[model samples]
Target: MRAIVVERTGGPEVLAPADRADPVPGPGEVVIDVAAAGVNFIDIYHRSGHYKMPLPFTPGIEAAGTVTAVGPDVTGLSAGDLVASSDVRGAYAERAVIDADRAVPVPAALSAEDAAAAMLQGMTAHYLTHSTYAVQPGDTVLVHAAAGGMGLLLTQYVKLLGGRVIGTVSTPDKERLAREAGADEIVGYAGCAAAVRELTGGEGVPVVYDGVGKATFEDSLAALRRRGTLALYGAASGPVPPFDPARLAPSGSLFLTRPTLVHHIATREELTTRATDVLTRIARGELRLHIGRRYRLADARTAHEDLAGRRTTGKLLLLP
Candidate 1:
């Protein structure tokens, strides 16, 4: 099997193409012939050592493909099953293994590319809106990086739940994309908090969905109504520095939370439920996934470069 191996953590240059023996299914696991792998910030974190991993490991965690073998103790799944998972091990390769319980059945209407693109970001958007800070009808919420993969999903999901979205974008193209995804109003990074205040008639929004971390942390707090929640999910520009909790008191007694997808899908039932909801919506044409670009498996370095530089919009996929 050909995979992107990281022998050391430093930069995207550390992601090297290498040949390895084919992965075999372990107990309670299934090996799939990977069709596509999702490129994400977490992969960048692993490559740059921001998130530690054992040396000489494959770099991806989400993919969709066809199951070719099942391990002992695994039932209800078999060869030829089309599955996708956000917890697959060594997903940046031609083949990967995942525990049966973590693999979600991809609906017949979705392609392998779409399934791979939707799992991690789709599920993340799901938990952020539905669990972290549930958006209520007539609620106006703020979404940062509203044209990126997670941003587009967050925008649409908020609209689906009957809320209006005020999105922040860096470029005209991104602003157009955000509006296409149902953003009610758009604002630039500069003076976004003031824009939010003026748009809401000085009331601000009920919640702010922030994935751009340090770059927008304080402003996200300022763009909220009194006692509103700030769901800080990702740090695309960089992680936010530690601050006093007392700061929240002056910021209208705001609530700040940093949530991850792992905690939301801690149980198999929760995992399947969330995955199914997102996939089914896609199948029914209610949710839309925007795949900005597809790179060959060996070009993983360029993919990371583009993503980390914020030069790409929508979901990125690696075709293996």
Candidate 2:
């Protein structure tokens, strides 16, 4: 099997291609012949050492593929099954092994590319709208990075739940994309809070979904209505600095939470429920995925370069 390994975490240049013996399934595990791997910000964290992993590890955490081998003690799945999963490392390869319990069946209506693209980001958006803040009809919410992969999906899901979205983007092209995804108001980072205030008639929104941490944290706090929540999910712009909890009191008595997909999908049932909900919505044409770019397996370095440079939009993928 050919896989990209990071012997040392530093830059995208460290992702090197190498040949290794095919992975063998362990008890309660399944070996997948990876059809597509989803390139995400988490992968960048791993490669850059922001998220530490054991040395000489493969970086990806999400992918969709066909099961070629099923290990002992695994039930309700078999060879030749199509599956997709998040929170599994080693996805940046032609083959990878994962626990059977962590893999979910991919509906026939979705292609391999779509399944891989939708798993991590789709599930993240799912829990954000339905669990963390529970968006309601007539509720206005703010979403940062509104033109990126997660942003687009978050925008669509908020609309599906009957909420209006105020999206923040970095460019004119992104503003158009955010609007297409159902955002009611689109603004750049320079005046995002003022724009949100204007859109809400100075009342602000009920919740602010912020993934671009550090850079937008203060603005996110200012964009919320009294008693609103701030769901800080990611740090694409970089991790946020430590701060005093006392600040929340003056910011409209806002609620603040930092949620991760791993925590939300901790149980097998929860994982399946969220994954199923997102995938079924896609199958029914209620939600859509935008795959911005595709790269060959060996071009993993370039993929990371573009992602870290913020040179691409939507979901980026690697076809093995």
Candidate 3:
């Protein structure tokens, strides 16, 4: 099977297309004939050594496909079960062996590409809105990178909760997208978080969702009111600078949490429940997935380059 292998961490160019031996399922694993793979910020972090991983691995984390075989101890699934998974290895390939516990059945109304697009990012948006802080109606929230993959869906989710969404984007075009996603106000964050103070009448917001990391961490916390929450989900700009927790107290007695979907949806049941909520919304045409970029499986490097460069708007995928 062909897979994009990362032997050394550096940049997108480090990803080399290779034909490796086909993966065989281990106990509790299932081998999927991958039809689509989702590209994620974490994949880039893994590839660049920003997030440490053992050397020599495939980069993608999420994919959707058909099960070709199930491993020992796997049950309630069979060959030809249409499914999607997150937090798995070797997804950027023609076929991948993922833990059976991580795979969720796909809805008939959702296509492979759409399901792949929704799996990781959609669930992240779900858990972020549902668990991280449990956003409430009439609450004022600020979402950075509000035109990006999870941002668009999150904007909608926040709006659905009746929260006021103040989205920060880098460009005028993205501002329009944020508005369409139901953001109450869109601010330009070309490189700063001062807009938060401006957009919220100097009172700051109740929650600050910062995925831009290094560039926006401190300001994101500062943009919140006393006792508000600061949820940092990604680090596209770079890893956040070290800070004193005492600063959080003085800033506003703020709550800070760094969350990941894997931590939120730890088991098959949890994974299935969260995935169903997002997929059902998509199936109902309530949640929107903008598949902003598509690349052939062999073009994985290009996909990484665009994502790392912040040239992408929404979900990016690789199809074989």
Candidate 4:
């Protein structure tokens, strides 16, 4: 099997392509021939050592493919099953193993690439809107990086829940993409807080979905209404520095939370529910997936560089 191996943690240059023996499933696990692996910010964090991992590991957690082997204690799945998982083990390879329970059945209406593209970011958007700070109808919410993969999903999900979205984008191209995804208003990073205030008639929004951490944390706080919530999910630019909790009091009793997808999908039932909703929506065209680019398995280094440099938009996938 061919895989991208990280023997050391540093820059994207450290992601080296190498040949490895095929993976075999362990108890309660299933092995799949990976068709596409989702390239995400989490993968970048793992490669850069921002998120610690054991040395000499493959650096992907989400992929979609056809099951070729099923291990002991696994049920309701068999060889030749089409599955995708957000919890794949060493997913940056031609073959990988994952727990059977973590695997989600991909709809026949969807392609393997789209399934891979949708899992992590799609479920994150689902939980952020439906669980973390449930958006009520008529509520106005702010979404940062509203042109990126997660941003587009958040914007569309908010609109589906009957809320208006005020999105922040860096470029005109991004602004157009955000608007196409149903963003009610698009503003540049500069003076975004003031723009949100003016757009909301000085009342601000009920919640701000911030994925671009550090760079946009203060603006996100400033754009919130009284008793609003700030769901800080990702740090695309960089991680935010530690701060005093008392800062929330002056921001009208604001709520700040840093949530992850693993907690929301801790149980197999919860994972299924969220994954099903996202995949079904995509299959029915209610949710649109933009696969910005695809690269060969050996080009994982380039993929990481492009993503970390913010040189691409939408979902990026590595095809093996």
Candidate 5:
């Protein structure tokens, strides 16, 4: 077996692929022969020491593949079932262990690659639109990084719920992609604040999804109508600096929250429900996943370099 081990908190190069003993199923866990691993910005944070983890570990959180074995206490899943899972150990390898509670059966219609692509980004987008803000019909919302993985999914899902999406992107190519994903107005983020005002008739949207964080926080705060909500989920441009809560009142009396998927879908039932809804849409062709980059397990460094430099869009995957 081979695993991309994170020997230290440093650069992507620190993820060194080496032969290692294959992970075996423990009680309440299953061993998956991984076909794909989902690469996320959080992987970068772990590499950079922004998110602390025990050193000498594998650097992936999500994977999809065929189940080879299941441990005692595991039920509903059997060997040879195609599945996708998050909250797993050492997913960036030939084989990984998945907690039975966190594993979800992938739709039979979906390919292994597609299942892997949708698990993390799709779940995040689903929870953001349907759980965190719970956007309703006629709600005008803004999505930053709208060309990226979660951004595309969120835009489409929000529109499917009859809400309007104002998407911000760094380039014309991404702007085109965002529009294809149901973004009603695609704004070039160079003059984002002004563009947002124009798009909203100077009133701004009702909710701003700010994953770009420090780079777009102030403008995202500005691009909202009174009593609007700002869902700051990720900090791709770096974390938001400290601020005063009282400032929310002066800034259109806004509501702000930092939401994560773990908090929103804590229980096994909640996780399975959300995963089923999102995966059903994808399987039925109502929603689509764009896997913009693919890297072999050994090329994890190059993958991170491209992602950190914003050289890729949509979901990035590591084929094991």
Candidate 6:
């Protein structure tokens, strides 16, 4: 089997293609023939050592494919079953192993590429809107990087919950994409807080979903209504610099949280529910997945380069 191995942490050049032995399932695990693997920022974090992983490992967390082998103690799943999974590692290869319980059945209406695209980002968006803030009807919210992969999903889900979306993007093209995804208002990075305030009639939004981290953390606080919540989920630009808690007091007495998808889906049941909800929505067309780019497994380096350069939008996938 072919895989992209991160021999050391540094730049995109570290993701070297190599031939390796095919994976086999262990007890309670299944080996899947990888059809499509989702390329996420988390993978970059790992490859760059921002989020540490042991040296010389495969660097993917989400994928969808047909089951080729099932291990002992795994029930209700067998070879030839179509499945998708998030929270699994080693997906940047022709075949990957995941615990059977962690894999969810993919609906016939969705293709493997779309299924792979929907799992990680979709579930993250799900927990953010449903659990983190629980957006209310008619409530206004701010979403940063609104044309990016997670941003697009977050915008759509916020709209589905009947909340008004105020999105921020880097360019006019992205602004248009965010608006098409249901953003009630769009603004660039500069003066974003003022824009949000103006859009909300100067009261500010009740919640701010910020993924751009260092680039917009302070502005995110400034754009929130009194007692509003700020869910800081990603550090796409860079990690936010440390600051005094005293700042939050004047920033509308705001509530702040740093969330990761793993903590939200810590249990098997939670994982199943979130994955099922996101995938079912995609299957039924309630959610639209934008696959911004696709690359061959051997071209993983180029994929990382484009992602790091901010040259792509929406979900990126690697085909095995």
Per-residue error for 8 in candidate 4, Å, reads 0.4
Error of 5 at 214 (Å): 0.8
Better of 1 and 5 by TM-score: 1
Deviation (Å) of 46 in candidate 1: 0.6
- Candidates, ranked, lDDT: 1, 4, 2, 6, 5, 3
Which regions of candidate 3 are displaced past 4 Å? 190-194
Superposed by TM-score, candidate 1 places the C-alpha of residue 238 at a distance from the truth, in angstroms, of: 0.5
Candidate 1 lDDT score at position 106: 94
The reply for model 6, stretches above 4 Å from the true place, is none
For all predictions, the C-alpha RMSD in Å is 0.6, 0.8, 1.4, 0.7, 1.0, 0.9
Model 1, position 291, has a per-residue lDDT of: 100
State how far residue 87 of model 3 sits from its true place (Å).
2.4
- The residue ranges of model 5 lying beyond 4 angstroms of the native Cα positions read none
In order, candidate lDDTs are 0.96, 0.93, 0.88, 0.94, 0.89, 0.92
C-alpha TM-score for every candidate: 0.99, 0.99, 0.96, 0.99, 0.98, 0.98
- Local distance difference test, candidate 3: 0.88
Clashing pairs in 5: none
Best lDDT goes to which candidate? Answer: 1
- Backbone clash tally for model 3? 0
Arrange candidates by TM-score, descending: 1, 4, 2, 6, 5, 3
Query: Which tens-of-lDDT digit does each residue in 1-320 have in candidate 1?
Result: 89999999998999999999999898999999999999999999999999999988999999999999999999999999999999999899999999999999999999999999999999999999999999889999999999999999999999999999999999999999999999999999988999999999999998999999998998999999999999999999899998899998988998999999999999999999999999999999999999999999999999999999999999999999
Model 6 agreement with the true structure over 91-114: per-residue lDDT tens digits: 999999999888999988999999
